[model samples]
Target: MTSALSLDGVFLVPPEHHVPDTDRAAATQLLGCDDRTLDTLVRRGLTVRDDRFDGRDLFNLALHSGTGRTVPEQAFAFSLRWMRGTAESLLAPRTLSFTLTAACRCADVVLALPRPDRYGGAVIPAPEADVVAGTTVSATIRTEGRAVPLRSPVLRGLVEEFAALGVRWVKLPDALREDESLVTTHRVATCESASRWLARRCREAGYAARTRIGWVVGMLDLVHAWVEVTDDDGETKVVDLIFAGFAAGVPGANPLLTDPAVALRTNRLVPTGFEVGARVARHDCDAPVTVRIKPVKE
Candidate 1:
């Protein structure tokens, strides 16, 4: 007969209810388990007092287990759940929506938000540097960006995968690509920048990517800043990031000057006029010629 509940790796729904029977059978097949496993789970107290574990949780856990490390996507999802609220409230619906948001956007980000805030470098507005000549132009654009250093592990893995694939990018797409941020269509936030090139690399590897664009502080009076992506179109685009300024302060001293060697490492926009006041590479620098103005690739 059907088991009362499933847990300890084998729980679906109550046997008496035929309505959930079809679902039970499917779960049993996917979980690769039988009634005996359910009994054992009940004895071990992993069972539900009222009934079986929620079907969705079972599916997510199984999918998570199966992923192993082929992707850190599962782990990232789980962490988002914990970051929302108390452990019990984790199951609450509104919180779940927050957890399942398609992607992070400049607007969706909340400043001084609680745990699970992975938006790039989190600069808490240094009181001293706060007043760097405010202007009418929107600094709001920069505020939404999560500061990410080029050294995070997840980004490193993606870059390596891209290099291995040997991507050959052609031209930018005629239409604006979809965004992972909201439910509706969106153009690439940083589309005009290097995102087009980065997306090509990831696509070649059978992975997905997006580019977040903006102008670098003190760099160009106006230029796009973008970070590469590999998350499945709608998950968090920027993970494991650092404040652009702190990244520059490390022992290497002036990180912006040294170009990244890898095909996929993320980096901050170079400061304004560092190389442009005059030619500044000291002979081992990897950056190509720094043009006075960014060139239009035709």
Candidate 2:
């Protein structure tokens, strides 16, 4: 390529405009508002900018369309977090936050499940965790490894949380609930967006890869995304995790009971073994956006 200065005749360069030192321009500039996209949304009247999604184009979209500002509520908390100390010690002095989830049509019971635990399984489970409860929901539901109490406030809270999310769930004390009736359920999330993010991370890690687009479209088909780690000897270990879009359905379950899994998934979104394209969308954030996966080699 040759420079304009070297051209035989005077070459014309496209005119460039610089930002002015005006206060309005300075403030709006920080918002990254462009005259083209943002001006369009606000002109239409859709959404208002609150303290969410951070002054991004999505805000402008809502502003123009006159759309109601949608915010994610503090959904629910987990019961397991209450199991912090020994079961005997954990009985009293406990508080849970929640909204009623499901309506149990069969029985006259009103259930309130626990709030979802953000840090539950995402980070490493406590080192002393399984040493006490043997790493199962059934074990932790009991006090001192015995089901003598039959029921606790924890179980009651568990019942209520599920009622909030429109799921008919029951608080099954480990000792009282029927084992065969309570089948172990497996749930999965199909996060198309996260798949793209992971593909980017894989490329960043020096692996030439692209997301399996067909597989992502079949998130219902592909079912899950697992973390695969390899040691120096090249023996690979894969850990299954809770990511975005997980837990759509399961047997004999309600939303409140299920969302705790999502809470664990949410708290684990950052720094807990990650790559790019690691999230899937819960709601369509407008049309799907894709970045460069890998540059084409010549």
Candidate 3:
């Protein structure tokens, strides 16, 4: 049996670290605030004392339309940033500094489950949300490992093969907690499930890879995730395995951005990773707004 390769360094930033700069104008609209209120706040300024505008606020006020109560921090952070920019821009056009720090470090939960050969086996385990106390032996979740670099040739190859699966998404009820559950319970592939399956396939194939939990642009509520591969050419690229089949007409696009609207919106990519204490800086003073990832804190 091949030894299971651990995917280290593939850390995910905690939800608190995902504070996104938001559009103040759009956020006002989504929060159902009136124009006069926005004008008042802009003229007077965002009060630091108000709990609604506190630093810990992670609500995605830009979600002009969504059913959930807890908004994405990225949306809320971006909104606050926009407000600051607008207020300062009126006085003078100066470079604004934006910094993102992970709220708390995160430890990965690695699970060892029954590996199904390509022919037949459970691709992933069900009850992914269930917590095990002491007696559980079917699977083992480990928490220690280094982050895997996505620029390995082996990983790139896995991306190609997984995309070749040509898995079609099976739309299940929103009632389902995780899209990956669909794969274990129903054998269908959604963006979430497909990415999970791809990560698994990469592991089974003996390449170091891991799954990430985040969203594609413009579809934050739907909550999209994908795989990051280290290529032989020293490039780390995000592979949307399922979306590759759906959008690229094949699965090997360099960035593999899935949403058409987001693809049309920008030429720059928002920096992605799961590093705690890593800094995400957005430079909008230039021609195109670009995000830069800084070294993770020790």
Leading candidate by TM-score: 3
Candidate 3 residue 25 Cα shift, in angstroms, is 36
In candidate 3, residue 28 scores what lDDT?
58
lDDT of 1 by residue, 1-298 (tens): 1222333332222333213212445545544556665446546653243454444334433432433321222433442232223322312212100010112223322111111113332222222331122111111111222222444344556544433432221112223222222111111122232244445445665655554433332232333334445453344344212222122223333332222322222222321121111122222323232212122222
lDDT of every model, 2 decimals: 0.31, 0.25, 0.35
Instruction: Kindly indicate the candidate among 1 and 3 with the higher TM-score.
Output: 3
Using all chains and alpha carbons, the TM-scores for the candidates as numbered come to 0.24, 0.18, 0.32
Best of the two (1, 3) by lDDT: 3
Name the regions of candidate 1 deviating beyond 4 angstroms. 1-194, 232-235, 239-251, 254-298
Winner of 2 and 3 under TM-score: 3
Candidate 2 residue spans exceeding 4 A from truth? 1-192, 196-226, 229-298
**Model 1, residue 266: what's the lDDT?**
28
Which candidate number maximizes lDDT? 3
TM-score of 1: 0.24
**lDDT per residue (tens digit) for residues 126-240 in model 3:** 3343222221224211111112234555555655555554443533333332345445444446565676676677667665556554323223223345665444554444566
Error of 1 at 1 (Å): 76
RMSD of each: 22.5, 23.7, 19.6
lDDT of 3: 0.35
lDDT of 2 by residue, 1-298 (tens): 1211111111111122111222323323433444453344334542233312223223222222221222100111121232223334322221221111222232322221111121222112222321121111111110111112212233223223333433212222223222222211211112332334333444455444333211111112222333333223333322222221123322223233233221121111111122333322212223332211111122
